[model samples]
Target: MEPPRDAKLLDPTTQPARIRAMYTDPDFVRRGLGRAILARCEGAARAAGFRSVEMMATLAGEPLYQACGYAAIAPVRSAPVEGVTVPLIRMGKWL
Candidate 1:
């Protein structure tokens, strides 16, 4: 499924590598599944010697990511989702 509005803040120029899209089903969002998936992804990146990972975040997800230690790399920006506009923030964490 396509991300919602506010899901477009990912700037390829600012990313360590091209950002890959990821998401958790809404029903599983509060069950720690998102964190688990992020942990696994980070672990694999770390094992591969990657120093960091990055993502563009929706307003709904920013807090959860922050709780996991991801921090903003830049101010929030406006992103278009479908034909709608939404706020987005660029975030990253060293692995």
Candidate 2:
């Protein structure tokens, strides 16, 4: 996956790695793929010197994140897209 937006401009030792996106095939849901991927992401972030990881998670994804030990930071609304908006939760975990 691509590095988080503007990653080069941020200091890994001070800034959290942004988990820009994550997905699993519907047929593979609940089969541990998400958890595995998340673990890998955290490992990569930690290895890169990031102190934490964060993301704006859709409601459908919030449960999985929560189950994996991420804490909800706040509720946020995505910027309008062609007059539509999405509800999301900001969540993070220390690595």
Candidate 3:
């Protein structure tokens, strides 16, 4: 069974595969699942011949990605979703 926290498969692209989404249940936060899932994504990307893994990190999630060795590529940007614009940071990790 999947853990309460989960990561989506990377999106195929000409550049690095992008982590489509990742979420951890609030009740299960800070239990290392996020880091584990991130590692799995990187491992998968590397196995697939990708040189890097990228993602758009939610404002709240940015710190977690950063702590896992992802480097920021640009300043934060806004994306409108569900009638509100949320800040997201572009981050990538070399595989």
Candidate 4:
């Protein structure tokens, strides 16, 4: 059966939506590639008419994103992974 429209994980009203997955490759990350990528994404979101953008962050990534203006909106919860319950932060920024 097909999933309900709203059941899709993304926000539909966020037109021209963009998704990015970033990591600091040893050669790229330490030199500020991640920050540059985030800045580009935010600019693209604004140009696309998105009022905001959202991201889920692992504990290690939280500080970086926060420093770049993303704010925590809520704490993430889910069933255990590998017998260890993990937590994540739901973060967002206005474009």
Candidate 5:
């Protein structure tokens, strides 16, 4: 069974590893699941001796990541999703 929320730690193909495919079930959002998942991902990175972690954030998720200590690393960028376009921000945090 899937957990109430989810986060994935991407292997470090680049200098600092990246996080991708993170999400919380709508009903469970803001109830700490997302934070817990983010913490788990960071913990794993630290355990693996990584210096930092990075992720691309959808507009809706930017604030949450900011609260988790991720800083915007670049200007907002747009990408197509489904049939519409949305903004994304690149963010990074030291482990």
Candidate 6:
């Protein structure tokens, strides 16, 4: 997906790596599984010379991202789907 139009990054010209569609099964919640996945992704991004990472987070996932050191970088945006809207926050972290 393209970067958000109103993204405010440390380097606007440098496109940060993106993480998408991350989730943990309800049965596996609180098992540190999500954090492990995020660590691996961040490691790979850093290995590839990326200085940062970003993702559009659902309200349910926002707490985890914040706990992992990602901060909100933009205002909440609505994603329309089948006549419904999902609130998403643009969050990012420097590697």
Query: Which has the greatest lDDT?
Result: 2
Backbone clashes in model 4 = 0
Candidate 5, position 2, lDDT: 30
| Clash count for each candidate, listed in order shown | 0, 0, 0, 0, 0, 0
Clashing pairs in 3: none
lDDT of 1 by residue, 3-87 (tens): 5556455443344532356687887778998888788878876665667788888878888889999998775766555677777
Off by over 4 Å in 2: 1-7
**TM per prediction:** 0.70, 0.88, 0.78, 0.69, 0.77, 0.82
* Lowest summed lDDT window (length 10), candidate 1: 10-19
Error of 5 at 61 (Å): 0.8
The window of 10 residues in a row where model 4 has the poorest summed lDDT is 1-10
Taken over the whole model, the C-alpha lDDT of each candidate is 0.74, 0.90, 0.81, 0.73, 0.83, 0.87
Better of 2 and 4 by lDDT: 2
Q: Model 2: how large is the Cα RMSD against the reference?
A: 3.6
Model 6 per-residue lDDT at 29? 98
In candidate 4, what are the lDDT values of residues 1-95, reduced to their tens digit? 33444544545365334444566776665578789888988887777667888877767789989999988879986457567766778788776
Colliding residue pairs in candidate 5: none
Model 4, position 32: C-alpha lDDT score: 81
**lDDT by residue (tens digit), candidate 6, 38-80:** 9999998888778899999989999999999999998676755
Q: Model 2 over residues 11-65: C-alpha lDDT tens digits?
A: 7977788887799999999899999999999999888889999999999999999
Q: Any idea what lDDT model 6 has?
A: 0.87
Candidate 1, position 52, lDDT: 78
List runs of model 5 lying over 4 Å from the truth: 1-14, 76-83
